[model samples]
Target: MRPAAAGTTRLLCLAGVVTAVGLLPWLSGRNPALTVLRARSAEQEPTREALDAVRRDLGLGAGPLHLLGDWAGGLLRGDLGTSWVSHTEVGPSVAAGLQVSLGLMGAALAVALLPAAALVAPVLVRGRGSAGAGAAMLAAVPEFLLATVALLVCGVWLGWLPTSGWQGPEHLVLPAVALGVPAGGLLGRLVADALPAVLDERWVELWRGAGVSRARVAWAALRRVVPPLVPQFGMAAVGLTGGAVAVETVFAVPGIGRTALGAAKSQDLPLLQGSVLALLLLGLVAGVAAAFTRRALLGPALRDASLTLPTARPVRTHPAIPLTLFTLLAVTIGWGLLRDPYAVHTTARLAAPSWAHPLGTDGLGRDVLARLGHGAASTVGTATAVCLLSLLVALALGFLPGVAAGAADIANALPPVIVGILVAAAAGPGTGGAALAVALISWPPLAAHAAALVQEVRSSGFLTAQRALGAPRSWILTRHVLPSVAAPVARHALLRLPGIALALASLGFLGLGAQPPAPEWGLLLDESRAYVERAPWAALAPAVALALLAGLAVSGAAYAQGRAAYDQGRRTVASAVRKEAPVGI
Candidate 1:
């Protein structure tokens, strides 16, 4: 197919996907307002009939398609419907959330992009791999985990910030960092990867050879690179929306995420659908704008249909750094396990060391150490499992065109928190609830990554050359595509882990993670809050462990990234020398 035709097709497909996603809440037998009404009705019988009457009054009896069309028409006319859950106009509720979400996202984008730019500067100027790796490590740790730790240190220990709620400027700091740190890390990697390619372009080299200053070359390259990066930035925005949901819920912030969560639990379909649709529109607009911008900036070159850029070289292995970092993290986690951070030692308490009372006694005469140890294990185990499972589902679904299309629409349309709320309400708040929530929320990004990876691999010259050389399709996929795609996929997967962990932990912290007598980290933190005046360490220790684990994970990933950047630098230098040597000879 012609490149222009192919591009047009892709765009149309994406648009369709976005539309479908926007409509998913209604299609899935869950209306934001309806869900809430159902739950509310369980407590009071008249409420259900009244809600049903309200639904009818709102023209819901005319079928969903008609209702959806009316809703869309209303939206186009600047009317967002009424919020059944809040008894406010949907427009105002969404507007309020938008203000907070946008503000937070804007701050986060600045925080994320500035550091990323700084990291990229070194790569562009001198091609230092270490800087690249450091950025990657930063990206790998989840935002929630990092924020949780930051909150503890700043809010609890130092009393510098509020632990929860968005009252003022102080409320923004922790959430912004939670959103920005990983984003910055990811952006840095993108800049590091793209800048070199931009520099290698014939026009760039020609400009450089014409005695252009390094600064001018860098500026010119950035101009070209930045347009293509709009899509990524949009993706980051979407991710922030997802993270914001959990963050808002954890801190009891009055934002879209929390509202959506509340609506979902109450089965309020209207509010849920409206919020989701707004988010979808936001994503779609951003994505389409980016695509158009790229085409406009690149002009007819994108239509040439024959020109292709060079592929990045294989990432060099840095076994030592990752291994060492992993070992240190393991040790710390083990120490947290053994230290009995949750155990309470009392002189006059009935302390006994049995299978049940592993850590002896506590202030209330409870087995402190055993609870801590078990809880830590369960918390970590559940988080790890959810991350892996969610990623796997995403990967599989991402590979299927239909599934990808559905996921793209759903993800773009609904905020992660809304989805989490719906899933959690249906499943009930527990380990299963958290897992379901994570899976639903995490799958969208994972699928998006998988689709992009497949597309990139399919377009590579290596695959084309293999086909020309009569290689079997399966062989080409296995030998060429998989290896080329694995490293980036691994990086993305690792980067996603912390976010998943944080989401689960947040649920636990919110009194929804696990049942009583279970040693869940979030639950522990919640329990410790009661004793904050008497024994602050009980709360402080678990929070610290959560943060340390997340930070170490991020650091390890960054180390690997640094090594990858270093390898890329070596290849670029070698390539440049080889190209120059022939001219010299």
Candidate 2:
């Protein structure tokens, strides 16, 4: 874990990720030439001669290894090759998309930071308890829903801002806010959770007693709290890019995410690969920036010592708020399930809410309420399966941290939506494919948690004593290590359930998940999009449900996190008390 080794590992991981994308054409279960031909000329007949010509032109029959080598070689020469569909060079297209994405991401980061900064002083002065609920509420709202609502209100109803396109700064406002607010909520929560621990450090009291200003003390504490969160911030940036698929599609912003989605849909491997590389490089840049920021914040101590920087720990928080939200969600789902989701009423299409159709009707006259209820099983059920499967995989990989951990490290950086694109290309789009795509990348966080906890448990004094007593390693591992790691990691996985659902929904919205006639939340939103401006309720029902679910999950997780932190605090205080106590006593 030296900095150099870590950096080297990351570079290798990035290479692995890019290499995987290069293999998409081979893995896609389709003929590259035919697929490209169809993408390029849908009206043309797929004769033998035309297929052979495409194969020769694209060197499709050369085998994957040779193709990959050529692509890599061209990459080194600053060539991104040509798009199969557009027949244009991929470089300029990717560059144009990247420019838009980078600007959007930068604006999002600023939006995230400003609100998070505003909360730090309040967290230092007040306790961390109240902030967690609010932060969870804010963070739980998905970008797609936010974009939809923003478009409806700002663009359609009020005409306050341009909703679609990358025309001007004015066009950026809605998308930026949609992407930024959730991130801000997360960042704010982390600072809030970490600040109380910093405030308890002896230096805070010393600084205050020395007549230091409150603002200065808060600033110092914030600086300490933030460095540990650099990784999370970097992940947030990656998440923003992943989320842009839906957000960009909703607003018609021509970002890399949108381009990648289009390429995936058309089976345009070269363009898809190039777009993914751009995103991967953006993630790399974010990581580098974070490392530099951390180094700057920690200064000499960061280099001089092997500091085990404190990360934000889960603490015990009040469960009432989350429990209430969960209840409301359950009730909504139950009510919707009682109605029939598929009963089409031509005259009632886009109808407003009424006694008969409680949540109103969609463009097809399907009951909005019923769709939400039925879609719950599809969306939430898949998400639950994904979470459980992911936890199992994480436990397995987490316990074996050699090559597996390194692979997990690589997989961690691949965005869920990008993974969805790859999965859709290989397996073809469906609910199963979407779940598989999400599960593919969801395990890394839990695995890392388990791996670190395993290391910590194995090194504990009690474990050392057990070893000296001639206990078998297997016995110790099963009795001590497994239990210790499993519970906390399971809780961590539960906390991530909502996020898994959101990822699945994003995929569905992009046509990579559930198809039409399925009441999946993402599909419902997708189905409602055409009429969203006219019949906002069609979209709002599912959007509202998703928001509620996110709020419940985040709030519940925050409570568990807060509770853990509280326990840790108590333990620290007791440890200190024991050290100061008289030996005889």
What candidate 2 gets wrong by more than 4 Å, as runs, is 1-12, 31-35, 124-130, 307-317, 401-405, 460-471, 563-585
lDDT of 1 at 553: 58
The residue-by-residue lDDT of candidate 1 on 1-585, one tens digit each, is 334544554567656544443444445543434554555455655466776776665555666577667767876798867665556787778778767877887888888977787778886787333344456556655555566556667777788778787889888887887778888888777767666666777997788789989888878877767766766766766767766766666566777766666655565556665666555556666666666766676678564443333453333445675576556546545644665444444552444444554434434554455455666567667767776776677656645645566545545544444445555544545787766666665666666677688788898887788889899988887787666655566567776665566667667665445755567766766666555545545555566556555555555555565576788889999999898886657
**What's the TM-score of every candidate structure?**
0.68, 0.90
- Taking all chains together, the TM-score of candidate 2 against the true structure is 0.90
Model 1: worst 10 consecutive residues (lDDT sum): 306-315
Candidate 1 TM-score over all chains jointly: 0.68
- Residue 489 in model 2: lDDT: 92
Q: Which ten residues in a row have the lowest lDDT in candidate 2?
A: 307-316
